[model samples]
Target: MSADILNSLARRVGDGVAAVRPAAAMADSEATDPVEAVATALLGYVSEPGDGVLGRLVGALGASGMATALLEGRSGRDIAGQAVTGLGPADAPSGREVTAGLARWGPRLEEDAFARSIAQAARVGARLLLPGDGDWPEGLDDLGVHAPLSLWVRGRPSALAERPSLALVGARAATGYGEHVAVEAAAGLVDRGLAVVSGGAYGIDGTAHRAALAAAGTTVAFLAGGVDRFYPAGHEGLLGRIVETGAVVSELACGAAPTRWRFLQRNRLIAAASDATVVLEAGMRSGSLNTAGHAAALGRPLGAVPGPVTSPASAGCHRLLREFDAVCVTDAAQMAELVASVGGGVGGSGDGDDDAMTGAPPPRRLEMLSSAERRVLDALGTRRSRPIGDLVRDTGLTPGAVMGALGALDATGLAARSGEGWVRRPPDEASVRPGSWS
Candidate 1:
């Protein structure tokens, strides 16, 4: 369990794996570094996802170097010091943060436990995916320092990079409406040649996975626990099927149990691994919102299905729509549109401006404008300038509201002032510009 023992075991595992399967190393250029794989696997066993200190250390020193440093009993700050020596000053971890991180990870560095986990993973047909692996999802790079140290993947590792993916998440206690929407959305996404990603919990996540499978599409499940022990044992069959057709993935090593914090962390991988996130149905306090938040923070497009306003089960979706600038997507086509907009860096608002980027005429730009802005534009004549007071009277809005709306329009070149009043810009000039207003 000591550092020396861990180092020795790591070397043995690395050498054995390399010697036994030279083809594996040859097949995957990135996997040639068996020692880095050993270290990364061990790190997955000890550190939690989004460990900025570990991420920074690995980024600066490389996974092999950082693993060697940790195996050599280097303190967190010591590792940090070495990692930051030649790097430009940025937001890298400070000595204090590294010290604290070391304290946190120190107790979890049981070499015996990690070795056993690695063996268990191998027995279960899981492989360790490092940063440079060809199968690694490039979308995750957007996470920067918070990206996973390494991923434990079961099934086809290439599935992770097979196509652009979308995250379909919702309440575990999902209503039939939610499940139906999730299934359709997932299937439609697959038909469009994109992969579906989810946490693999019950309700919406499970439904999405099943639907994707039913449609014979690739779908990946990110687990909070280890891939060896699927959570919600009810979905064992589903997980197995996914292992056959897609992949079951995790940041934790085998034998690790799912925890509340790990579940939250797992949501980030779901968000980051996908091009967009869709919330079918969630309550006011649903965990799906956590995933949605991660998607928004990562600047990924987000979509939410609307439900009966009277249904409390739809409260979270409504909240996301109302407060989080989530696109109101009802059917698969709308969801596809959202995914299509993702390449434009459209983050979740789903305002439809991105359509213009694909050589399509931009939809009415006013649809995404604020009500006040829309009202002001409506009140102003295209060819005639109207004063603020006139706009307020015509729109039945306050003078301040009129001025604010005019200011927004002017900023976007949708409105221009003539003499002492404002006029609506030409339709051609007012057409939506991708990534401009959003």
Candidate 2:
């Protein structure tokens, strides 16, 4: 772990006690002295300095606006505290100055207990990422003071900078329409080469991840808890696949369990990291609404998939469209188009740009298949999978046409049957490499 990571861990520990207790665990402890409780907690880590490191650190941070500087690993600098405070501009440091500062502080912090705590977390599958690392999403910087000093990633490291990323958030106790919308939006985002980002909670978030993975598109699960202890425990397998293909990210250090406060904090990262954020379905009081709010606050383009007006699960999205002015997206093409209109445009994956469907060669072989077969296979490209019925409906073809497509899909190794008669196939590897198919 780096010094920036160590400082971030310390900050998260301090903030945890300062914030409201998690909703799931606040049983009649409201009468306790909040400051005393926090101080007592601090004692368990730092040796009792008269003024206390936490207090001094907070003061120093306030004076120098040291949060961003800390992320930059510029701790040893003696800049005027007034000038450094609150996202202020500064003289660019020479390469030598940066190198010297890191060289001095790196080893000292490495042996510190706080650093060890973060390291322990990493040992058990957690990852620590600062602003410049591969796992760091530049969008988080938009959070300003609320931005995490370092993100503690539980699952996939590749998710940090993965392109074509969009956030899918909604209520955990989602309605069937909400669930269906979540799956559709997620799969559509993947088909366009974007990764789906969401909190690894039960309802909409889980659906998004599952759909993205099923489509062979990347999906990122941003957790509020330590990576070692997957929250909702039921989604452990889902988290596993995300780590394999995308990533799970956080701001807390290792061993930091999930709490309600962390969930809100985690929301900011999801909002800021993506080029755009989509609320597939959410209730008026849904936690997903928090993410949507954060995205809008950051000036990130926000979208919602409309649902039945009767669904409480979709009320939040309706509110966004009605009150918050969120874009209404009906399909993947619009979602991708909206995301591209903002900054998180998808297509290239450090390999090559996504093929433009407009001028591509006419598919003679594909044309041989019935319309439904062609439609099903069309959706089964290099990223994700789709259900036969989804294809049937999406293509406006009959069930027989869908079935014929499935048969050709299996024969071509372009798709394979999976659970509940759904079929999935990743993009063909040969198409990605030169002359492989020939």
Candidate 3:
């Protein structure tokens, strides 16, 4: 990557952040340093969010120090050598680990990609937030090395820091019962003068966000990909409305696309950014459980809104109440009290429940399925048949893994062969109305 090009783009983005949220509007923090912005932006471009090797390097060496090392084409072994001194042996990534990370990050280091990313953010009027920026949320710092290198924000940058935030997340295939609860809860929380945070997906997340907006309350949407491109294209209008008042935030560079792993990684941010997390409705395998897992891991208060025990969609919430000691919350008042009334939560992400909200173990009903099988099931179509290749591509699974997952799914009656492809079979309960969850 050309440092000159990176620096130029960073300067442009810096100016754009200033234009959108002037210095007067910034919190009483030091002025954003152009040099640090360039370095942070470079790290964002070279590595995916939550990259452990790069995260530790940046933590030890600072963004500029790490970026300079990578820009100079220093070998990962050499870079690891430098990081070990600062991080100490206990925390530093090994040479092999750093080299592997390099392999994952190296191909995306093109200057043109960086330029496009900068242009996209500018086009979207996003402000850049470095670690010490006044508007940068302190809660994110809890993640240590896993915290975001920088954040891209659209809408009022101050919205992130304006008030305490609560994360309300659940399944994209949310039940009407779930939506009703989410709307009521979100509206109540906002009315009580708290900011709401949720991934901007369909179903429960969208319901909570819309309810908060209708209440004329502050809310934040944490995205898995670039804030510039709203995933689940159907939510573009909702996301746009969010940017009209509350902020839309992302750690990934502007050109990055959402993926399964990234979606899982993104859950950590939503959990970290909020004071508490509430699961409105989730199935045994709902991604919202993953978010609850993150919240539990951070010792943030966790709550689960109960649905009928008969409803499979509520199984994860019940699991939380029964297994993880997540506070049983029915209304907004109870949800808010989860943060105020409770101290912390224990245990999360047991087996494999991954993103839409994101962690817990697979429900007992599907406990036999491996994580790979779960991923394949996530990528499969409910009615439409998909060939093994499509599943492989969508889930980022190797062909062999996809085949194995398909085999497991078939035996479990969760999927079936159809015209040389596969379709999800309806379980004992009704199949959910499909939408983007991960």
Off by over 4 Å in 1: 1-7, 15-22, 25-28, 344-438
Distance from true location, Cα of 430 in model 1, Å? 52
Which lDDT value does model 1 have at 327?
95
TM-score of 2: 0.57
The candidate that wins on TM-score is 3
Per residue, candidate 2 scores C-alpha lDDT tens digits across 1-438 of: 333443454455543433322222223333244332322222222211111222233333431233334434454444233333522435333333433433322332322445455446635655444444544577776654345545555556656777767887877887788788778777777767887888888888888889888889888887776666777799988888788878876555445555443455567778788888888877665667767777777788888888888766677778889878889987777777777896655663222110011111111233244434544654453434566555543333445556776887688676786655555565465542111000
Sort the predicted structures by TM-score, highest score first: 3, 1, 2
**Model 3: how far residue 360 lies from native, Å:** 4.3
The best candidate in terms of lDDT:
3
Candidate 3 TM-score over all chains jointly: 0.79
Worst 10 residues of 1 by lDDT: 353-362
Quote the lDDT for 390 in model 3: 68
lDDT of 3 at 108: 61
Q: What does the lDDT come to for candidate 3?
A: 0.77
Tell me the RMSD of model 2 versus the true structure. Answer: 23.5
Backbone collision tally, model 1: 2
